[model samples]
Target: MDITVYRPGELTAADRAAWAHVQSQAVAMGSPQLGNPFLSPGFTFAVAHHHRGVRVAVVREEGEPVAFFPFQRSAAGVGRAIGLGLSDCQGLVHRPGFQWDARELLRACGLAVWEFDHLVEGQKPFEEGATGTYASPVMDVEHGYEAYLGHLRSHSPKFVRTTLAKERKLGRDVGEVRYVHDERDVGALRTLMGWKSAQYRRTGRSDRFARPWIVDLVEHLFHTREESFSGLLSVLYAGDRPIAAHFGMRTPAVLACWFPAYDPQFSKYSPGLVLHLRMAEGAAADGVAHLDLGRGHKEYKESLKTRDLTVSEGWVTRPHPVALGHRARRAPVRALRNAVTAHPVLREPADRFLKRVGRLRAGAR
Candidate 1:
């Protein structure tokens, strides 16, 4: 096997095709991280305009590609999986039983430590690494929208009634309610971004939209179309105005929910909740089985989740002075994160402080 590395923009058409082929072969792959246009060369190109650490490592045998890993290298000798916070699945796209080893790959890339926060369980590279796990709430959307509502009613009576009542009131007081899955409305996306940014600031968190590359990448992704996975923008409108919107990716089997936001003016109506219901309905109709709500501990997620699967986030470090120091510092932070996650009361204040710090850092940047 031969390993070669290329910068993000330097990838040729053949490289992309090979990469896509590997991604398609992963059984647990979702469209949000692996197949979305945001993770494509064009979007990565836009991100490369502002950042300097994008690279791809490919392993080939007999002059054919077998595995591909996308990552970002930092001056600190640390590397991160590409689309870190924005992507749900992070790992090497490889053929079955490939010979790549996680630590060996990091060493070859000259990285002291490689970090990831959202990784699919049992995936290569991360499978044997030291890690911690968390559950991502998901809803099965296979039995059609009405069937799902029935299931919700049986399982979460109050939640279903409240959301449905709100929807009715929204239509009566606001206007006729409408939902568009795979909406072509770019203005709705801008609206979602604005609302999401406001929510971030209100919670004292860093606003992702403040970065030009992130903003542009999302816009560029919306316009990109592909067959296996497509960027989907779902909008809920009232009287021709978008009240709530969600941006995610759709493969044949899954609808991976990424970013969702709603106009605060419709807060009482729970427009976001209504929009999620509509999204679930659409996914079921389209034969999508699961709606991956992503990793988080929000009350809505818990209420809507029928089952929970564990996912992990951590680092595999090299045996070096710099790596040791970094790990030593990170140990306390990881312990704190674990403690907070186990106890919501402890987590809330710490999360608040982190958010404040993130906002300050954002403001400085």
Candidate 2:
């Protein structure tokens, strides 16, 4: 195999066609995880258009592309999954039965350290490098919306009842409730971003929308329309007002849940949960098989997930001082976080503490 690197925009039409072919073949082989829009060429191109240092390592067999590894590199030879902080799914999109030495690939791309979180499972080459693995909750709607609703009703009868009751109350108290699955309105998109930004601030987390590049990338993705990938915005409206909204990415097989937020005044109505329920129904009807809630532990995730998928977090490093230093600094922090998240005893308290800090920060602001 010959490995060559190119900026995301530098790929020729033939190269893109080959890349898409590989991705399609992977999905055809029953690897739906590779169907994440985050791994699609559209996502890489969008990020590359708004950010610098993005590269794709194209591995070719007899000059035919068989694999693509998209990443962002720093001048210090450190690499990260393309759109690292934002992308929920990360991994190389490779043809079946193709394998390469991890270090060799990094060297070919001039990377000393490669870092990733939310890496798709079954990546054997990076398995040993992972410091931790976590369950990413998923909703299986392959059999259709009714089947999934039946599963949820059977498994979470009380949750379903309460959420639905709240939805009824929301409609009665506000106005006629309506849902838009693939909303085209840019205003709704901006409203979702505003709610999401406020949510981040209230939760004492760094607001991603505060960054110009991230905002640009998101808007660019919103306009992206491709066979294998597209940006999706779903909204729930009550009396002509959007009560909740989500901006996520979708492929034919999967709907990757990303940014979701609800109007604070309607918090009692649980609009976010309601929106997800509606999103699943719409996705199933649209022939999407899974709704990936991403790698995180939340009360709502626990209640809504039909099953769990494993995702890993870690770094791959070549034998270089820069690589060693980068791992040394990050490993301990990751270890501590993993330990906390792995046990409910630790996680619950940590969540409470963060909320308290968030309240204090918001009050101060």
Top-TM-score structure, candidate number: 2
User: Per-residue error at 308 for model 1, in Å?
Assistant: 2.1
TM values, all candidates: 0.86, 0.97
Candidate 1 achieves a global lDDT of 0.76
Question: Can you write out model 2's per-residue Cα lDDT over 213-304, one digit (the tens) per residue?
Answer: 88888888888888878999999999989999999999888899999999999999999999999999999999999999999888999999
User: How do the residues 79-153 of candidate 1 rate in per-residue lDDT, one tens digit apiece?
Assistant: 776777777656666766676677777877778887777766556556565567788778877677787788788
lDDT of 2 at 121: 82
**What clash pairs does model 1 have?**
none
Q: Residue 153 lDDT in model 2?
A: 98
The clash numbers for all candidates, in the given order, read 0, 0
The models' CA-based lDDT, in order, is: 0.76, 0.90
> What's the residue-level lDDT of 308 in candidate 2?
97
